[model samples]
Target: MKKPVAGDSPASSLSPCEIPKSLLPIFLKHIAAFIDSLNVVVLARLLPQSHHRRILTASTSAVAASLLSQRQHRLVLAISTPLLQPPAASTRPLLPPDNGIKKNVQGPTFMRKIWARDKQEAIQVEFNDLGQPIDEKSSSELAHFLGAIARNGRYAPLHYKNWIKVPQTYKKEMLTQVQEKFQLPPGQEDWILKSITKKWRNWKSFVKTNYYDPNVSLVEQMKNVPERVHEDQWKELVTFWNSDASKRVSDRNKVSRGHQKMVHRKGKMSFARVAEKKKKELGYYPSRSTLFIECYSKGETPGNEVASQAMVQNRVCLKSINDPTQIVAKGIVRSIDPSTEVGGSRLRPNWCEVHIQVAVEWDEELIRRYGMFETIGDALGAHVAWPLFLVERDESDD
Candidate 1:
């Protein structure tokens, strides 16, 4: 059927229906809603026809949550409600745009979006402009300190499998306080602060063990420190420096994660007694470790007795870590060097303390080295390498 077209005139150039410019917003909103394919309701009444949005996308945003910014509210709604409709039958896998994308945003990542929006939003905040770089000595000192830290074995995060967050034992900006107090000019202040931070880092690394050592007294640092204006401030410093509650929390989380990895379906029941388990509560303690060993001959078979005794010997080696593991005195036969003899007993055996006087060879100059027994046990389980008899000296025999 032939239909009559509009006559050639100014009216004809215009769209015949002429969806009004005034109505464009209303129509476009409906279109977006249709494209989104969500249940949308159009409100015609509230703010007169001029300002009214056609389709109010049903938001899950709560009233209180929207106080921060409308964008947050929008994001909550956008995420909570799936925007894309499922493919009818067969299509590419449904994915939100940019599911796995890296963003190199400056400032805080969490606040990046907000800042982008409210860059013009006026608010006053004070910031001490950073001091400029000063003499090369400061820079050199800082560099040296940082390098030393990297070389230090004490702060070995490598020892831990997880990203053990080395507690911020030394603050980078703390030196700024001293610098500022001394009224050193900007350049010098920067240099000094930088230097102090470097020194702190270097010291941490050289120690070979973390600041979390039980024997290292944090409170003692306070004793050496000069008289301070506020004692409370000193206490706070000591509290954090001495006890790395943050790192401890992190270590626990790492252990928890490791434990979560082993989900037993239905597994072996232990024959080891509850008391034994309680007594030697092995594994998953703070910085705790498990060592399993089978020892006989280095090249051939080490007898069961030898392996069994190795467990006790293993305990001795771990003890050295508590002190220093340079020596192993366990199970050595040597003559008493002392001229004086005991009145009651005539024997001073050359045997050293398993932990103390050393007869066994140990090579611990740099990297951690364990005793022969401890090393073997760390490799083999006690059940596999246990000795039948680990004899103790009888008083009667003595």
Candidate 2:
């Protein structure tokens, strides 16, 4: 009689006592192999049909050969086709359902450790005058001192345009604090104060521009800003930018004729260009009208505060300096910046300046009827590019 393979039923109607005990182990082994083959088929079915069929066929043939005691057949089946093989790594889902909970618990911790390592490399950890690490306490104390000086105004030089360039008094005060508190030598104290000042200003500038939340504390903001640059490291970067090799490259680029002139076209040419061309053909140059006034100064009138407030609201009226009643043109205040030194060695006003973008409009019928220059020259292109230059006036201004 042929020996029954794994998982085969006993053909004879017999009890367990009737079966040979020696065959029990073989029966169990075959049963386990049969179950494993079933599992392989079930998992392989998750793959594409062709892959699933190939894996199933190879696995079943190998199992059958093993049960039949055909070693050569089993080896051939295993070697010829990758039967009973694990699924492709690419095919396997990265986030398996069984591991989802474990991944959720551990993923953030792993990422945090990685980010911390990267940050440590990027930041220059600061040290106090006495070679102690300047921690949160030191930064807070420095901020308080700086804030006090700013409130006092005279020693702080907060009113100065170049306020960030630490004044002598500010430096002296910082040095005194560092010497008394940190107990370092005068030179070391000076160094620490300078480094801290640079760090503070850099942090403040970033916080002012980026962090819009008014409720956020300054301490928190400073903590979140990037670490202070070491003096030596900053010098390295400066040297690189100002290197002789860099200068030579810049000079060569300036002399090179290979660069193309880039014309930025926002839209079609302005109507003024067409009108101007038409006038030129008729042997007439277009009449000039002061249609726009960009920068206007009302010299130190009604104090800086009042002037700035008015400018912000766009309340200032701009009429012709020559003939105010003529209403040659009007200006809508676009922005106002505190007056800084301009004209590079010529005279400069200390007062704030109103920066206005002009309001110019031309009736299409009027322009066509006049057959001439009712509007100004195209700022963007040859055509009267009014849309590009013109900004809608505020309803209140109207």
What's the residue-level lDDT of 177 in candidate 2? 40
* C-alpha lDDT (0 to 100) for residue 394 of candidate 1: 20
**lDDT to native, each model:** 0.32, 0.36
Candidate 2 regions with alpha-carbon error over 4 angstroms: 1-13, 57-398
lDDT of 1: 0.32
lDDT of 2 by residue, 1-398 (tens): 35557776766434666558899899888877776666454444333343454555654543333222123334444544444433222111222357436554321011222123332243232443344334444443433443333333333332232345656777677555434433333345644554555545444343233432335543343333211222233333334334577458657856773432212231222223333444557576443221111112224332222233344436333333233222222344433333332122211322222233343332221111112434422211111111111222233565
Candidate 1, residues 184-293, lDDT tens digits: the string is: 44344444445444444434333323223346577554433221112343344445545567468657866976632112221221112221233356543222111111
TM-scores vs. true structure, each candidate: 0.18, 0.18
* Best of the candidates, lDDT: 2
